[model samples]
Target: MRCGLVLVALLTLPVAAGRADEADDAFAKKLGAIVRDPRQSLWARVEAANMIGKIGPNAGAAAGDLIAVIERLRPTEQEPLQEAIVEALGQLGAPAKAALPAFTRLAGRTIDLDLALKQSRDAILNSSDSQEIDALARQLLSRDPSSRVRATKALSDLGPVARNAAPFLAIALGDADADVRRGAINAINRVTPNAKPTEAFVRAIAVDLRDPDANYRLLAVRALGRLGAPASIAVADIDALRSDPDPDVRRAVVDALNRIPIPQLPPGVTATNP
Candidate 1:
């Protein structure tokens, strides 16, 4: 009886596995049907696109169909469909790489391509894997105008893993476009917590501190603080900044000094006293 029971348990395993696979197939089929149905309203189609993205590469066979839909609907005056297509491409992940060349070619002919590329950047940046992030960053770096913006955004999204892109980011600091330069500086400040601000960057911020651009000065001060205590003593201008006319700049200096882990005072003198 024991032998018979063991034999029966082994026999049922394949059947159970098959049932699970069949269920997944049925679900995929249903989603495909919804996505393909012309009678569906634009909103419904957008919803279907979102569902497909959540399903991931399980819907690989449907990639061609989805690409076609994105191409056709991209030019439509409807915003919802365009949004849906962007979301769907993100869901497609690396599988969508095959479609990129075509997308790039199309991008050359129209302004809408910029929006689509931005959506792709958002999707890739939000992905969970470092490999995907790197791949997307490399692709974006190949484009003009978009390259600098996308790379900056990607570095921000990548957080610590973006250390590998340091060389490229360093070059971006001198970009002709001020926005790109600002973004690169912001990204570097974010990715390199231990980074000592370069002399050029320090001087740049110093100049901006007196500039009319309040936002520029604000970002510079914030970046300086994150450079931590090591940088404070290293920078020649730190003493001067302690007395900056801008209250915010002075506050930032104090905060930066505090970040440096100093030894306890020998006697009565306290951190606040200094």
Candidate 2:
């Protein structure tokens, strides 16, 4: 919520640069100052870098400055700062195209790092190619992790307007690549926070809940919790998971059960309070 860019606690937060609670001239100026100042604390710099993306295309004017900030930090594993800066470039879209070479140089570091760079680079270069939206959406199921990652971010960037892609994204929750799985989950949440969970969505989470990987079970439980009322469709299956051997999965199930509210009883029915 802080960046308005991410919702699933990805390395970088979500950006709202040109969307809700738009970032303005003065706000960008303040962040730019912090980003440019060598004396600033690392967290402050990270926050400033993120805000630039939240400022979206409005921060286009600061693209050079943001690039400078990246130049100052990218020589090593500057985790938080790298995420923030690349996320900022993603927000700026095509305006940050000048930094594509830098991103290209930065790719292949790690699955996460490479995906982040590719996402931002593509966002800045081809995200607006409307005709390709369908192709990208289908790509979410690609066996290639890179293709899946790109599709997830693209669909995510498209937001709720990407109604058509939601099912694919939901299915991606079970991807073997942890990064794709997480990115797909993030995209699904962002695209349908208030909508009923599609049957496909519920099925996808169900599959994850059965996964041998505890992480998938944990993520699926957390997803059911986030889906709230709509996720009640999986109540029986989720309830059965209460005894899951993994403590984390059990905790997640408890959290999910707490999240899905009970329906109202009939007037003739006697309801007892817990």
Candidate 3:
């Protein structure tokens, strides 16, 4: 039995090691840098994206970098590179969900582009692998804010499957860095839209409505709104922000209030809304 187990382990070791080697962030970052370097040949950039895609889940951190390249090339007549980037995002699967919004904007432009976008979206939603999700969740607690931001972006793309990372994201909502805080709320909205909003979670996000940065407040309100009826717990707080000093924040607050529906409470249980 021991010899048979040893044989099986040896058989699997190479394949596992190969994937681990590809997951190296340094390698993925180098490919991302190549994809973004304008001076590089067009084919070189396309190849770089293709390489990153081939790296699979571990290369998820490069999704934002690839999206930046896509945005820069979308207007130009670089159809081939655009297609390659889109294909790479599809290959990245669930980790590339962050690209769906960008693909939505690029839709209606052409048949090929639309089809590619649909395929990528399907791939992202159909992905069942938990390994990538686990890796990004660990990155959520990284000491570096940039790493946390990338993890949040990737986790947000995961839909309900990222529910386990909610606690980390909640803590991130209070991060000292505005960008990290913004990313955290964005992640919460996308990652746990249907999750039962706990008092602590709801309160953690509600605190953001009073954040010093107007943009953070606006994003927090939008995140809460995205929670739909589940976020009714924050309705009173959001309503109070209707007269916020920042016009955009106030506008978002009103829109959020509109989005949150009246929750059905038990008999004798009062509604949380004011």
Q: Pick the candidate with the highest lDDT.
A: 3
lDDT of 1 by residue, 2-38 (tens): 4334323333432232345555455544554555556
Which residue pairs show backbone clashes in model 2?
4-14, 4-15, 5-14, 5-15, 6-13, 6-14, 17-54, 17-55, 17-56, 93-124
Q: Sort every candidate by TM-score, greatest first.
A: 2, 3, 1
Which 10 residues in a row give candidate 2 its minimum summed lDDT?
Answer: 3-12
Report the C-alpha lDDT of model 3 over 1-274, residue by residue, as the tens digit. 4433433333343224355544466566666777777776776777777777776767777788888877766454677778778888888888788888788777776678778878877887667446677778788788998998898898888867888878888888777776677688778878887657666566667777887888778878987887777788777677777778999987887778678886654466543332
Off by over 4 Å in 2: 1-129, 141-146, 158-183, 262-274
lDDT of 2 at 52: 77
**Which portions of model 3 miss their true places by more than 4 Å?**
1-23, 128-274
Global lDDT scores for all candidate models? 0.58, 0.72, 0.74
Q: Which number leads on TM-score? A: 2
Lowest summed-lDDT stretch of 10 residues in model 3? 6-15
